[model samples]
Target chain A: MKDVFKPEFVKLELEATTREEVLRELVDLLPVGDDKKELIYQRLLERENLGTTGIGKGIAIPHSRTLALKDVFVIVGRSKKGVDFNALDGKPVHLFFLIVAPPYDPKNRYLITLGKIAEISRELTRKKEWMEIEKKEEFVKFLNGLLREKK
Target chain B: MNKQLLFLISLQELDILIKEKEKEEEMGFPIKPCEELKKAREKIIEKIDAHLMRRYERLSERYGNPVVPVVDGICQGCYMLLPTSLISQKAKNERIHTCPNCGRFLYWVDD
Candidate 1:
């Protein structure tokens, strides 16, 4: 596990009204100035258009690779009321992991993040624990613990 | 066997189970699975399988003709650079080697 993720990068209580709304909100959370905002937004939109990021089990991992950033940043969000995300499970999504990485990176960090999300999504779905999480720090701690897991 | 295969097998089993339940429901009494329930189950299974298959095929080609292991923090698939600590820790068998760059699970292989 690399130390690429920081606590500040995580966003909690994202008030997204819909799937598209959440996607836009996630793009806004990326660390990019006005000069690079549009470029990053477009890249993310392009990836979404390619396919829905909803991985079912009420979770979505939206990610993209762009030159707009110097490094990778991830944002974790939760919707208390759940948002219509077009998930295959037909359940509203409450968990989201939005990732943005530099295009020049030799490896596919996006896929790795997706894999990590997938691994946890299955367990979380089984436990239905997303609804039980009450505070933002708790969410962050859960993710940190997950990152610390061996293998 | 890849993860996609596992997903497909699980989905197929669910589909069959749902159908059996639906047949029982049609006999007059409601059961664990019904016609409407079976349809929904089939739809979900199809979507998941299609999504996984599409991604697996696309990524398999993008990385290389054959899937390569990430070993000693290096992408045996491409021999790209990885973190020194990652490789060292993996060499000591203290932790699994994941490509710092690719994030794929690394495996030690002899050529």
Candidate 2:
């Protein structure tokens, strides 16, 4: 419902080869202090340990609600070579959607944003060019279009 | 950043994640079991002070999140402007703060 996803948050080139590194790399995109960023990454790792957010296919959604953030934010990252995230289907993860939310989300933006991401993920399988999109704007536009198609 | 305050912060983080997972379940998404989360919460609760625990519970019942971050001298819980004196503390996080307007425990986000 909210256009929390931005082209600035999208990175076409992710250098991490492992799950931990990928999550850390995504957290680096946040515009916050170093200490706050570390707290968000730690909370993210805890969530990943509990269960893989990789709903299978080349996607992984690493998320957490932490006191470190003041609002809901989402970062979209992609790796040319997939990283092992201990996904549900035991496949390498090429795309990452990291969602970090403030502990006290009055409008429940985090959950709504998450639900929107899941909806887009479901439509990902049919779109083969998801990873092929070059420009960040084009990539984000394509993703936003997927959500629009749902309606 | 005392031991009790540290534990309380971590406890609140765990609780938020647990609540998120529960919300996910209601939205028809499958989530991991909550039993493990409950165990972790119990472990943290055991480490916090008894009196602090009661205060946290009482505040949580009053405000969904008993612990919140102070961003630029504003209480994120109730959006009330915190006193500048408290904000200018040399060692703010050394002791937890309660918002005068909302009474929720506040930690400095800048630190």
> Which runs of model 1 end up more than 4 angstroms from their true locations?
A3-5, B1-111
| Candidate 1 C-alpha error for residue B35, in Å | 35
| Residues A24-108, model 1: lDDT tens digits | 7777766666535655565556455444567677787776655445466788777877888766667888888787765334575
- After the best TM-score superposition of candidate 1, give how far the Cα of residue A57 lies from its true spot, in angstroms: 1.6
Top-scoring candidate (TM-score): 2
- iRMS, all models: 17.3, 2.1
The fraction of reference interface contacts (C-alpha pairs within 8 A across chains A and B) present in each candidate is 0.00, 0.33
For candidate 1, the share of real interface contacts preserved is: 0.00
Error at B90, model 2, angstroms: 2.8
Per-residue accuracy of model 2 over A17-36 as CA lDDT, tens digit each = 99999998999999997877
Tens-place lDDT per residue, model 2, B32-86, is 6889879878988999999999999998788768888888788888888888888
